[model samples]
Each structure stands twice: as C-alpha cells, then as structure tokens.
Target: MYGFRFEDVIVDDDAAADDLQAHLADAHGGKARPLCMCTPAGVPMYVAKVGEHYVIKRMPNTGGTHAPDCASYEPPAELSGLGEVKGEAIQENIEDGVTTLRLDFSLSKTGARIAPAPSGEAADTVRTDGAKLTLRGTLHYLWEEAGLNRWYPAMAGTRSWYVVRKFLLQAAAGKVSKGEPLGRSLYVPESYSQDNAAGITQRRIAHMAALAASGKTRKLMIAIGEVKEIAESRYGFKIVAKHLPDFPFMLSEELHLRLQKRFENELALWDSIEDSHLTFISTFGVGPTGIASIETLAVMVVSVNWIPFEHAYDKLMLDALTVQKRRFVKGLRYNLAENKPLACAVLADVLPKPVALYVQPPGIEQEDEDALSKLIGESDIPSWIWRAGEAMPELPLPSHDSASPGSSLHRRVPPRLSAPMLLAQKEGPESAW
Candidate 1:
C-alpha cells in the first residue's frame, strides 16, 4: 500500500477507509499539499473532488518523479509520443482540474452535403502539426488517461467492457474538446442486457440527440466501442460495434475502401491474433431517417488484456510480460511515425531503475538503428532491445537488494524543496511538474 502525507499526518492506503476518506476530504481545497510518499523524496499530489468523494491525483507531468512501483509512476514522456504534444495539443488547467484539447478535425459540419475527410489515413504517419491532435491522437490520449496503458498482475481478468466504459467516461469527465465538454459528445457503449435493451437504446438516443438535429449544419458525436464486424450493407458497408448490436453505423463505399487502405496493418494484426480486440473511434451523425453514418474513423488493435499493440512482435512481448506477471506501462504512438524510435514498453518493477523495452523491426535500416541507439544513449533509464529476427532476451529480474539500507537501490531523499517543484530537468523550461 502507498503512503500519503497530508501535511504532517501520514496515512497508508490500507488504513481504515473512513480515516483515509476523512483525511482526503480535509485536504481538499486546503493550503496543505498532499505528498505521495512512494519515494524517500515525496512526490507532490493534489486532491480532486470526483463525484461525492475526494481523490488524490499526481501533479501534471510529475509521473516520472514517483517510484517505479507506485500507481502514479509513468514512464518519462520522452519514451513515448506524448513528448511531442504534451503542452500544445493537450493543455491541463491545474486550478480548474480540466484538460483542454486542440483537435485537427472538426466536431460540427457546416455544408448541406456531408463529405467526411478520411481522417483515419493519418494513423501511423506524422500528419499533424504537433499543435493539434488527430483522431488517432485523441484515442491515444483517452486510452492513456483512462489508465488502460498500464498493467499489473492483480489486474488480470478484471478488465471488461463494463470496466472500460466506466474509466473512459471518468477520464472524459473534465475534458474539453473544441470548447465543448467532451463527456457530452463522447459515447461509450454500456454493458448490454436483454432485459434492459429498450432502456439502453432510449438513453443512447437521448445522449445522441444532438446528431439528429435538423439543419444544414449538422453536429457530430464521437463513438468509441469494440468492433464486432465490418460487413457489407445494402447501401455500402456498416460497422457493427460490440454491445451496440442494434445500432450499426453506416459508411459509404469510398470511406470503406479508404478505411481498408489506411488501416490495413491494424486489420491484419487484429486478424492474426486470437481473442484480441479491435477498437474503433469515429465521428458520426444521425440523419433525418435515423441512420447513423460515420464521418471519420480510426481503429486500434489491442490484446485480450485490452493493452494496445503496434505489431505481432509487440503482442509477443506483451504475452511474455503478462505470463511472467511483470508490471509495466505499454507505450503508445500518438502522432509518431513508424520510422521514429520510441520505447515499446517500460518495465516498472525492475531494480536499480525501471527499464525501457524497445523492439527493432525486422531488417531495420542502418540510419534508423543509429537513431535508436542515440535515443537509448540519451535516456537515463536502462533499455532492453530485441531485434525482430533474433531470439528474445531475458527480462531483468526484480532486485533482492532493494530492501538493504545501504544498497544503491535504496530510495534517496533529495533535499526538501518547495511544494510542487516542477521537474523541468528533462523536458525544458516550459515543462510542468
């Protein structure tokens, strides 16, 4: 259990529930800052009122400061594509406890005729200006914020559509996109039950009523759900989302072809793996006839555990990691291209320090390999690299010396500084804690 220090009073997470709740409630909106004592040098955290309860949240961009085993510990931004658009496309308002997003795509259509741009084409390529997020970038952001990117041994077999929907909605609660509350425009399918079908459909229609508004300017809503199938419809093609069986989304033949061409790799990956899931995020609008048509869409392939993966090699690594019961964060490529070098995953339970895991594609170019080496060299975190054609290397084991008082692995408390010290050491002066 993690220990948190609210002023001079330290509280363990496993302490009496009422006591912890009382402490958190008292700490909320107070001058006394809460510190996560996960390391010798405590990491600053904030208390946010989530619904009727108060909860502690890590300070923005301070995830790297906590100990590896801590729940709030995240791999350095430089290890993933999050480094590219942290402050510009995604902005966090610390005072308001909200995140504002700058999107490259439109949320509302203005023309009389609907001609959706093929936004899914930018899935693996660098098509964004780095100042705004693409459809895939938004998906990555939501997945990461929902805590779906991290895996722990205890989490095995605990994830389902119900759990995913809950977390995704929670993540979207305080987010704003295009000056609108994201929760109002985002739809995640609820767990379906035959007895509650009519009520579920009624709620879904009510939530999506904006899309059914009559006018030349049509509003669009974002839908995220698991793919059941993409089969031929009478008009063109329709996407069947799991748990939303009665509400298949329609797409034009052109868009269908574009989707196939754009996400060919993702489709192939999903097809190659058994028990894997294909998740889709799309902007759609309902017509006067009550037909839902997709405007723009993007797809991601995730393991049975719902952790996203880029290729077969990534799945292999994830399988091994899960089998061995190691805790790690799966790295995601938001707007980054396939040619770019980024950690595939980061092992958090390893001793000395967390290790960044990299998978070099088969027959990588010499220039790319050199770039990968340079990236590894620049990082303070140790790395484990596996060339696609070679045998997998053994993962680093947890250190037995971590408990020793004088061991190098022992947590060293840096001299106490002011509360909320923004760690701009790695990211530049503009970086936040």
Candidate 2:
C-alpha cells in the first residue's frame, strides 16, 4: 500500500482511511502539507474538500513525480493534449481548492431569435489558442478529474451510470466556470429506477428550473450522458440519452449534418464496436415549449469499462490489457490534433518503470512517424509500439515480485484481432476511423 506523511504522522493508505477525515480536516486548517512517500523524494500534496469529504490531491504539475505504482502517478502532460491548456485555460488555485476555467462557449444566450454559432466535436481536428476550454476539452477534464481515465482489474463490472454521475458531480464540486459554480450548470442524468421515477422527475425539474426562468437571456446547461440513440423527430434529429428517456435533446438538420461530418471518426468507431458507448457532452437550453435544443456538442467513444479509446487499435489494446488484468491510465486528447502524437496509454504495473503504449496508424507520413519516435525517445518512461495492419506486439511483462508467475499478471501475450479490427482491415486503412 502507498504511504503518506501527514506532519509527524506516517500512515499507509489502508490505515489512513480510518482517520483520514480527521487528518484532512486538520490539513485544511493550515496544518502541515501531506506528502506522498512513493519515492525517495516525497511528492507534495494538498487537501481538497470535495462535498462532505476531504481528500488528498496531488499538487498541480506534480503528477509525474510520484512513483508509477502510486495512485497519484500520472504520465507527463506533454504525452497528452492536456499539455496545451493545463495552466492557461484551466487554472487551479491550490490555496482555495477551486479550479477556475475559461470556456470558449457561452453559458447563456442573449437574444431569443439569435441562433447559437456552429460548434463541432472539437476532438482531434479542432485547434484553438489554448486560452479557453473547448466542449471536448471540458469533457476530458471532467473525466480525468473523476478518475475514469485510470483503470485497474478491480474496476471491472463495477462502473455504472450511477457511479459515473456521482464522480462527475464530485469532480465539478469546487470548479468555477465563468464566475459560476460548475455544479450548478452541469447536469448528469441520474440512474433510473421504476421505484423512484416520480421523485427523479421532480428533482430534475427543480434542477433545471433556471433554464425556464423569466428573462430575455435563456440559461444553458451542460449535459454529459451516454447516447442511447439518435432518431428522427418531427422538426429534426433527437438524441435520446440512456437514463433520461423523457428528456430528448433536439438537433437541427444543419447541426446534425455538421455533427456527422466533424465527428465521423467517433461515430464510426462507436458504430463499429457493439459493446462500446458514445458519450455526448452538449450545451442545451430548454425552450418555452418545454423542448430541449442542443446548441454545441462533442462526442467520445468509451469502452465497456468507460475508458476512452481513439480507434479500433486502441480498443483492441485496451481489451488485451483488461483481459490480462494490467493496471494502466488511458490517455486523452484534450485539444490536440489527430496528426500529433500522444501516448495511447501508460502501463502502471510493469517492472523497472511504467511503459507508454503507442499505436501508429497505417499510412502515417514519414515526418509524423519520426515525430512519434522522437516523442517516445524524449520520454523517460519506456514505450511499447504497435503499427496498424500488422500483428500486435507482446505487452510488457508485469512485475513478478508483485504477483506469482502463474497469475493473470504474468500473461503478456499479444492481442489477437477482434471483429472490429478485422472489419477495419477489410475496409482499408481509411475505415479504421
């Protein structure tokens, strides 16, 4: 278990759980800062009060300093799109335990007749000044803060809509965006139950009361939910989320086409994988007629365990990792373009050091391949590379000191092509989208 130093007290994670509240409370009151003793040089940490509980959070820019096996360890920001807007768009105030975000999109509409500007999925293709968070960047931030980007064998089959909503809400607790608390503007559909349908509806109505308030400017709420389906409506396309069957967000024909064009890769990936989920983060407002219309939105495809993957190859690699019970952190592309190289994942259970996993797409340009190689060479952590259209390489072996050689952790077999991969290959390199 990981150990932490709280002033003169030293405690392991398991033992600290019993008295964590007391220590965190004291830490919040200007007591000595807690240090994670994962390495010879301890990593500084701060106490953040998340709702009713106080938790230890690694200090800003200190994630790479922790040991690979430590829960707080994170691959360097440069390995992901997060490197672009870490301190600029998303500013963390360590003294106050609040993160202030600057958003490129507006939270409220001024004129009733004026339509919102066109916005697309912002996933890999969009480029910005790094001064504000795009819709997809915001989603990535929330997912990362909620700990959904990290996976372990113990997490299998334990994640559900209820858990996702809880963690997302908790992540937004102390976050401030555009001078308003993010929790007030964020809506995550609660898990549905026949026993509490009426109560759920009532609470949802109360929560969205601001959107229907009397004013020239209509307030907008950011909703994050799994897409159940996108069907034709009388006026346009309607998105039906998994939990909220009663609430369908409307999409105009123009926006629908734009969504299809901009996020063709994400949509294609979601369509190709039967068990995968397409998650949407959208800015929507409730009209006077009780209709919810989406203004701007972004989409992402996540695996069965809710870990985001970029393509079919990524999914195949993740499947192998999960099947082998390897612990790893899935990398995310916040605002990075598709051409840029980023680690697909970082293996945490490997011996000697963690390994950064890279999947080179087929027909990649020579310069891009060189850039990817340079990225891998620059990183202190080792890397495992897999080129598309070829057999996958064997995964790095996990530490035998941590687990028996006969255990699942010792199985470092290469991944076989799944149905999705076979389909992608059959359709050619372009179909890997």
Candidate 3:
C-alpha cells in the first residue's frame, strides 16, 4: 500500500525498480523540489542514499503515518526515550541520511576510577536529568532505530547473528559518541557461517589482537553482544556471547561479584523467563594474552518479541498484551531507576492517545505514593494503573473492530491516586515479589 511520488508524478506500487530509481534521481538533487515517497495515504518520505544505492526512508517525525503492517510503521513516539530527546539530543540531517546525536555521558573515561563499571540497571540511578539519554539509553536507541526491535510473524527463525551484525553496523555509521564516530570504538564480530567460518575467526582474532595491544593509557572500547552465559573460571568468570561462541570475555572475580550484586534484580528477572535473552553492553579491554575482559558493563533483558523489559511486572504485562495480538511500545527507563515513577508500557493502536500503563510496585511506601501521584499528574496523556495488591485486572482492550483512521478507544482517565495500591500479601512471610 506504499508508493513513490515525485514532481506531481505518482509511481504505482508495482512500478519497476529501474523506473523508481530514475524518478528518485530526477527529483532535484539537493534542494528546491525534493523527491517524496509515501504510504498510499500520502504520508511523506524521503529518498536516502545508503552506500551506492538510494533507498526510501520514512521522513523525520513521520513514522506514525504508515499502517501497522508496513515496514515503516513505528509505535507512537510518546512511548519511548526517542520522544524525550527528539530535537535536543537527536538531530537528523535528512539531506545526507545521517543522524547527529549529542550524548551527555562520555564513552571513554580518563584516569582511573575507584569502582569498576556499574551494571546497566545500576546506571539508571546516576542520571542527572530525564531529558538526556544515558549510555545504556543510547544503546537502546540504536537498537530501536536500527529496526531490530520490529518483528513480523514471517521473520521467525530467519533472524541470525549475521543479520544482527549488519544492522548494527549500519546503525552505528554517522553516529557520534563523545566526539568520536561510534563505529571507531565499537566492535561487533561478523557472524560465522559455514563457508566463511575460518575467515571470520581470523578476522575476529586480528581485532582482538588489536584490542589486546591497546595499552592501559588507551581508552576502553565498547562491545555489545548477547550474553550466552557467565561461567566460573580460574581467573574469574568467562562471559560467552552468543555471536562469538568460541571466544569468552573475561571478568575479574572482584568485578564479576560486583556485577552480580549490582544487577541481582535484573538477573533474577531474566532467569525467570523461558524465552528471553540478556544483552550486555560494556566497555572492555583485551589482555596481553588476547583474553578480553569487561571494564564496566550494562545488562538488558529482551523478550521473545525482541523488545526490552525492566522488571517481572513488565514481562507479565507485555506477555499478556502480546497474547491478545495487541500492539504496544515498551517504555525505557532512560535515566530513571526502576523504583521511579515511570509508565511500564504504552498501549498503542487504539486510543484517544496511546494509553500509558503504570504498574505499581508491590508494597509501596509513602514516598513511592507521592512519586507515583506526581508522575501521574505530570503525564500529558491518559493513563491507567495496575496495582500489585489486587488480582491482575483486565487490561483495557484495544478497539480493533471499531478502529478506523481516526477512531479512538474508551479512554480511562487515570484517577487522582493517593493511597498505595496494595500488594498481594502472602499470609505468613514477607518477601520481595
């Protein structure tokens, strides 16, 4: 249902690829009359030159125009950190197909710090303001922008590590981190396939060799990979990533113990899932023996759908909505810690506006209630609260049958919540849920 339009000429969806290319080139190169592409409904798009070929990309601030089934379809921006930093932190230069990002945090730190790097979850507490994206938030932004988080039924079992690496490399291009191009300091191994297995291994060895030779005075590099396991070893703990099965990154016993303690809640959440993966984003250095070890690392738990979740409550909520064939966007913690007043999820597709769902942590204290009330009041859109004390309430059903271009669901205005939502108390013992 999407087609290209240029200079008042519309190309049918079935138009030849050559024909589309011709029109894209013909529509004024730099300025004046820009070649425009759009969904059948006329949502504007732009032609982007990626490497050697021109590809159609959704126009900045126009992702909501595409139908949900379309590849360009993105959930409402209000749901994610993307909304928080659209103009200030993230700036797009559509003319060149590059996005410039201003990060508040430094990727590489100078001098030595007393403590090892904090776990991803622990880093949230260190945020100074909600507007700026933390280092972990920046990584989540890259993943989402790369379209890795988007999924369709047909893609099942078709996604491999090779595809992931390609997408990530593409996303890292033109991105700036701490005054350096992100690609310069980032290392993601090429996926190993049968024919290229040996070649891939050799390339990986060379890259690791370079990292190993990087002296202590050199800045630490960033590495992002799926965590396969953390097993105890003589030196400390070996971190095996799914993409680099043969190579395990080393973590010192002290650092490994600190990571475990810092992210115990996150680890427990990931372990509870049957179909989930733990993604580790860390600053690492290679040892003289070619063994790599983490300097500081952050961890995120991704669901079967590929969207990230913070807590077990979020996992349960998203799983329920996913089962009902509903579309929604997962909320990012950004700089806000888990204990903060944040929407757990934003239900998309049906609404006056997308509904913000806040899951109250069990056994809320007085200050927590105050924080929740303040958050609820500050939200610009409609919201709903699900408390831990009650039996899980029926989620607001999306009005799919009645939903048309502009139709909205029954909006449940969040109440002026004062008392803490009770947590389900076990009769005898007090335990963390």
**Can you write out model 3's per-residue Cα lDDT over 180-201, one digit (the tens) per residue?**
6777677786654577677767
Name the candidate, 1 or 3, with the larger TM-score value.
Answer: 1
Off by over 4 Å in 2: 13-18, 112-127, 402-433
Provide the lDDT at 425 for model 1: 16
TM-score of each: 0.89, 0.89, 0.77
lDDT for model 2, please: 0.79
What is the Cα-based TM-score of model 1? 0.89
Model 2 error, position 258 (Å): 0.5
The model with the greater lDDT, 2 or 3, is 2
What lDDT score belongs to each candidate, Candidate 1 first? 0.79, 0.79, 0.62
Could you tally the backbone clashes for each prediction? 0, 0, 3
- Would you give me the overall lDDT of model 3? 0.62
Least accurate 10 contiguous residues by lDDT in model 3: 414-423
Expressed as tens digits, the lDDT of each residue in 274-340 for candidate 2 is: 9999999999999888888998888999998889998888899899999998888889988777778
Q: What is the lDDT, from 0 to 100, of the residue 202 in candidate 1? A: 89
Q: Which stretch of 10 consecutive residues in model 2 shows the poorest summed lDDT?
A: 414-423
